[model samples]
Target: MGAAGDMSMRCVLLALLTAAAAQPEGPRLISANVGIIQVDCCFNDTVVDHGQVVFNLPSKCLQLVCNYGKIIPRFLGDPGRSHCCEFDGLLYAEGAELAGHCVVMQCTRKGWIPRGDIDDCCKHCSVYDDPHFVTFDGYRYDWHGYCNYSVAQTDRTYNPEAGVFSDFEPCFGGPSCLGRSTFKDHKHTVISLGHSVFNLLVNGDPYAVPLVGAEPVRCSSKVHPVLAWRNGQCTMLLGSSKLMVQHCRHRLDVWAHPTHADNLDGLCGHFNFYDADDFTSRQGDVHPLEYLPSTFPHSWRTLDQTDYRCRQCKSCPPPRVERLCRADERQLAKYTSICEKHLGSVIDRTEGLEGYLETCVFDICMMYQDRRNDREVQDWLGILQKNVNMAHMIINLRLGE
Candidate 1:
């Protein structure tokens, strides 16, 4: 059963790899191109006398959700990376309101009905208003940070040993409420990339119409920016599907760098490609800490204890811990060395796949909507996924002065 669980983890990793590798080479996230929109979200009116109302949009359309029962984790990686982990730690999903437990059959249509708050449901992926808020302290997190944060991930588990995220606090402030802390000197750099939405139907064309939003509703813009976090004076925001097709494949991998500042928190919000810190000091006058929540698990120790920003606390070991043989007592050292080398591989491949996403899937979305070639559309998705999914990430952080 344990092995079966591991296999399931691997399958999820493969899907993430596919997403990373399929990075779109275009302008950040274009509202018309990528990201999710809840407003005007279509849903069939369940006129049934006591029928429930739920947002029946695609999992992608849902940024965050809340409901009862176990949390069904989908994938955890960068916005455009192929590498994803099974959230070895716990995983938590929040809800605006919790409806009574009931069974939902295969009802698939788009729109929302009146049942309760938006939080009373579960899906493949979930959104955290201020993903970093669930923490004990105030600090927003990034895509990579949430994926790799041992404490946050562990809390999601339904195990008594894993504990519940009740105190996890509900997030409501939108994506950027948490400060954005990037790799190295908190300098703001805008990176452009493409976005792709795979057409599930094999017979439909990849570029066929109905590209996001309702068929009759015209999309205002192609992309938009979502504020994910705040870090002191330095804020980080991620642009979505706003770029051209060619640049979409450029994953955030290249953004990885180092910092030794005091606000490193349990897990540096700037995750991916490397686990290095980029802040030198919270009082650096350039970077400052906020009252946001990012309190983390002790398991997430700092890369360097001397880097006052990072405090070593309890942390969960990597999944491959047993893979390291005690016979090779030195494997502990080998483990760190390997992680340093492999930690960010997911980012690299995800970045690589971004190009393919632009060329094959996203760029032709409009074309597919009009052409309606299901087979061709499925073929594109197949190629993109086949090319993108992979295991683990390659970390390549070069220490600097």
Candidate 2:
């Protein structure tokens, strides 16, 4: 076999080992390909993990589908009103892993929130799509106008209606005003699709440069934190930010479209944040899932929280706030009793829980390839849910009655 094939096998084994060590009870997720899962035989767990009660696994389970259910129509957030037709009885139908590790079998009070419905039953709520700011793309538009990419400047000029974007740009697909250039301040080309990458890979030809790794820089992809783009070279450095969180081994997002990143045949990378920044402005904030945990308002949103795809992406995710939902004095006794019964163990357990929650964030993003598109989203979600359910928690979607 070629050297590349040997290397791929080695990497797969290494990843499996690493995951087993990290999560003892839960299986580690692996994408054999975009639509297909690895389906490792080792991941069938005999123990069930639940939210109200915590349980650890006797052994490691790799990848497996644990739960399967179609979303009830009222549970899913629709532009206008998606009748039961929209609510297919399947989760992880398309893009990703199951829900969280805790709280199995029911929707968590703290679980994902969707918005927009006519009345309570949403028999009459306006469609999820609005004509004004909503674009053909699914990315969200920021109403606060604070979404300008400039780190320092506030009132800078940006043209949203520029021409088409070049292929091979490493971000949300569709057209964007990539704010100002890290190359030059106030220059629009910084946000131009493939401009930064083209400059980095210039043989004076953008397309001529083959994808350097197994992955191509597709839309919905993340960048390294400190990306130095100039003179056709992108020196990616370690940065915690979404635009540059890559591990240097570049690959296409699970959602990388067939054919190319952009070029409207099927409209694959069309819904960039720039594209959808304002689509739901009149309806909801269309918060990126990454920022869903932040205390952003969701008056018009379909759910109070977003989907795994939205939560996992780095699209300049909203600010994360520290939340403290203090236990009322009345209920403190219940929690206190447990804490007192297992004081030292409780401290350790709490710390472990916090650690898992942190890593789970990335798991969420990596789970769904193209999470925003409501079209046939259930299939994508169903697969992910099955994976999650097998190793992690039981997931449920609930609507306010």
Best by TM-score: 2
**lDDT of model 2 at position 348:** 38
- In candidate 1, stretches whose alpha carbon ends up further than 4 angstroms from where it belongs are 1-223, 226-266, 269-323, 329-401
User: How would you encode candidate 2's per-residue C-alpha lDDT over 1-401 as one tens digit per residue?
Assistant: 45775575456545654543343343334555665332222222333222111111101111222221111111223212111110111322111222221111122222211222111111100001000011223322211111222111111122221112111112212211222123111122232223334333211123222223111121222221122211112222111111211111111111111121122111111333234332222122443433222323222121111234433433444444432223355544543443233233323333222222222222222222324343333343332233222112101212111
Q: For candidate 2, report its TM-score.
A: 0.17
lDDT of each candidate versus the true structure: 0.23, 0.23
lDDT of 1 by residue, 1-401 (tens): 36765576466545644443343322222246556321221122211111122211122221111112111223223222221111112121221211221111111132111132211121011112123221222233232122223221111222212111111121211122112111111112122111232111111212222322111111131111211222111112211211111011112111211221122222233222222321112112223333222222223422323223233332433222111112243634443343224223443454432323222322233224345465654543443343233111111111010
Q: Estimate candidate 2's alpha-carbon lDDT, on a 0 to 1 scale.
A: 0.23
How many clashing residue pairs, candidate 1?
125
| Cα deviation of 347, candidate 1, in Å | 18
lDDT of 1 at 353: 27
